[model samples]
Target: MVSPHSASDNDNENGPGVSLVEIEPGVAVVMGDRPLEALGLPAEFDCEVSPFQLMPPGDIQNLADKISLATGGLNLAAQGVHGVVSARGLVRLAPETMKAMKSGLQPLTSGGKNLGVLVGKGGKIAHQIRWVPATGAAATNVLAALGSAAVTLALQSQLASVSKKLDKNLKETQSIAHTIYGDRWYDLMGLYKNAMRAFREAQDLGVVNQHTFSLVAADLSNLEGKRGSFRDNLRRHVAALNTDQKQQLDYIRENSNQILADVQAVLVAEETWRCFHLLRTAHISCDTTMDPALKEKQLAHMVEQVKREYAQSMDEVSRITLELERMCSLIAILPGKRSISFFGSNNTRNDGEVARMAATLAKTVSEMRNRVHAIPEKPEPKVKALRRNVPDDVLVLLQYLLPEDEPLLALAEATCYGEVFSGSDVYLGITLTQFFVADKDKMSQEGIIDKMYPLADVRYVRFQEQGSPMLEMFTKTDNLSLLFNWWAASGPKLADVRRIRDLFATVMNIPEEEYRDDSLFAEAHQAFAAAKTGMKELPRKSRHSAG
Candidate 1:
């Protein structure tokens, strides 16, 4: 313990204004008008100080020595202060050291009213001085406020990130929905709905802004509507395509079966006839009981009969096969044949598969036709075959007109038109290189000569009926136009004329725009001009009733 000393022991008779009081064995509190300043704090350090109030407790000897140095060696007890002092205590602080200490204490002083500074042995500052509030409630409230602010900021950041992710997901879902179709579309739609649900939930949770939510909702609705419309349209298109494909497939299958059966029958008949002829020839050639010349004659007769029979059988087979090939070629040209496979694997096939089957059947038909043509035939006596008597040339011409890869498809006789030239009528026929006009009704005594025209030279073909039916053809190279007039009394029927026009359009590959009749345009224009002039149209009397 240290005793109070008189002021006379120091320089001033009046003691120093600041003093130190020992609060515990090693701790003392500084009390004075300016205790912080006496403790070596800078003048710039701002803190509340009261004369009676004690400063934070610190090492007793350190506090005494600091007060003595600040007051110029005045006794602390002479100023009415009492504290135990140690000889090894620190005295003064440099300006830089005081600044560092001020900075260290600034947080404590700014925090609360209650603050404490702890010191260890040799008068060194122990950890840091902590400013604690007088009450636990105030401290708890401060901490809670700080935590709330931090949490709010973090939540906002997370929400912003989530919003961005949701926006990207919505766009991706919409793009995928547009690309997929059929039942696959439904699956994608379900996923889109799920994404929308998540977005709505996020909006409810306040993670998405109201304005952004509204915009996204509108976009999603539009996307869904477009997807629904697309699905409906696609379904209708698929249904129509499936119907057409099924019809064509059925037709091909039925005709192919019929042709196959007919060819089989012809083949069987030919084979049986061939076997019988071979047996008969062998027996006649080997028979020793018969005369050699008689045997030779019999064998020759049998061979001739066999040849004739075989030729007839082959001709029948060739005809049936050609018809089958023609049907297959027609099937190949039909539209909407590609998408038929998805209907079901059980009864439906892709266009490639169907085309392959048609090609195979056509190949078989061609081989059979070749076999028919390969048989040797004896030359007949030369005679003038009239155009009316030999219609086979017309058939040959029709065959030649078709594409090499496609079989010849015959035109019905009703679809062929006859034109009367001079006093003779010649029916038109088609060939690969030219059109042949032959007199099917008239046979000349000298012979029949058919008129021909090159097809490639023909440029424009038009069928029109102004007063009577007419067919016109213009040649590009020759620059020649040929017009055929039809008299109602002897011309082709109306149906035949229509068919002839349509066939010509198909063969010429005429566009729909070119084939359309625009002759009425001039008359309509005249009527419009008359109407604009406010003129009354006059009705012409009918030819039959005018008399």
Candidate 2:
């Protein structure tokens, strides 16, 4: 704080660590040797190596970004240079940078060029004495005057040459990109012409994914933003507009894609959608256990499910599968769907509405069928492509249930047991149109059990085909006294075989054996539930028996 001549004190008094050596007369290396000469730059100038703690952090960061970018570009040249060194090495030897020059020039010697400097000059000189030869005299000249105006001029000259070369080669680039991009960007582009071309080529070569696509997109965006600002500035200087000049201003932009098409908009509004949907219409088609072979285990399971519903028609199996698929699909669509169906339909039944309802149900049915058939185990080579478009949860569940071509048994034991769909007029007796009979409505699909039937004597069954049992039996078309005694004889309990078994027994004064088949579905699921181990044992013990 007190002494001017002392180095430490002088720095703090002025700017910390600032010195005459670092504090030059506002020096910068411009892009001309003549400009450098006018400035009378030393053979080497002192660059302040700011300590991270001392420097204004913002300034340091900006400088770091430029240095990093320049270093990367320089490193590209050194890759070909025989004695190429790292940025740290070049910076290390920065003081005696001339001595360190040959190493950094190695890549150029390998038939490359750099108008940029040997980075990390001091560190490079100290550690590795890379004795690389030059690619050409021009490369040597640029390195010799790096960070000075002469070096800048060399870069500028290189840039100008590059610009000219680019102008000359633009047609070739466009040709290559066109070949690569093909039809994806046929009517769209900018640098996307090049970028999308590259992306599609990568895809063709089996590399199209989010990461690579994003990086290329980011590069093109940055390049375009800069180019756009520069183009705007140039347009400001034009006093008179010629067609060619105006064309130059509009060159790339005239073909650029200004916006993405709204997918729904395109689908509903345009010809492209008809083409896409038409194309879609045409195509209609893991794990673990080292103890058993994967393929054999899977085949065995498929054979087993096939055997269970034996003698049933394929159409019946299809109906069960179709129902489960439809149900799952309805649940899937319900998550994001709300509709006008809820508004007017306090069970609405107008003909126009009914037709629309049929159409919706048809679509729902089709999607369900498609999904069931689209099982993961069963997908053929081409089915992979079509099924690739299914909803995620459906795909995940299918993968779990139908692994390795195993056939699935879509059993809906209790997914909807206690559930009820409201409204009485829903499908009380099916539908009758003037010319033909239309039948079954949405409530019927939702399990609105609507029937009953009488049996021998006073005892009878509450048949599903009957409209309502409770409303009927109370009017006592009596001799009902015998059935009340029958119910008391074999009392109902939760342990009963089937609800149907218990109900028939109650209404008919008949034993379970006489009333229903013991191997009915109700009995089978109860067996499976009780016997936690071994599916093989239960079916035998609970076999359909007559006693």
Off by over 4 Å in 1: 1-253, 338-547
**Count of clashing pairs, candidate 2:** 32
- lDDT (Cα, tens digit) per residue for candidate 2, span 1-547: 0011222212222211111111011122122111112222233432322122212334333433333343332332222223322221110012233334433422212113222221233333111111222234433443332233222222222222222323343343333334433543243233424443443343243333344344344443444443344233323322211233224223212211110011111111111211111111111001123343443344344433332322132233233323333233332232333222221234222323322332333333223222223333322211111101333533333332222343322110111111122222211111111000011232223211222123222244332212211111211133211111111123231112124223334444443444665568988888877776667666767775522
Q: Give per-residue lDDT, candidate 1, residue 15.
A: 28
Global Cα lDDT for candidate 2: 0.26
Q: Could you tally the backbone clashes for each prediction?
A: 0, 32
lDDT of 1 by residue, 1-547 (tens): 0112222323333223333222211122344333343443222212212221111123233444543443334333224243433222111222233344334533222122222333344555322222222134333443333222212222222222323433443353333233323454444444344444544444344333343234334344444444445334433322332433234345444434333333333333333334333433433433467996677567567666655655664554454445445434344434334332322333444544544443443344333322211211221212211222435534443332233333222222211232424434444544445554445442122122244555655567787666545565555333222223443213345445555556555555334545666779999999899896654333333444676
Please identify model 2 stretches exceeding 4 Å from their true place: 1-205, 208-351, 364-368, 371-547
Task: List CA RMSD, all candidates.
Answer: 47.8, 32.4
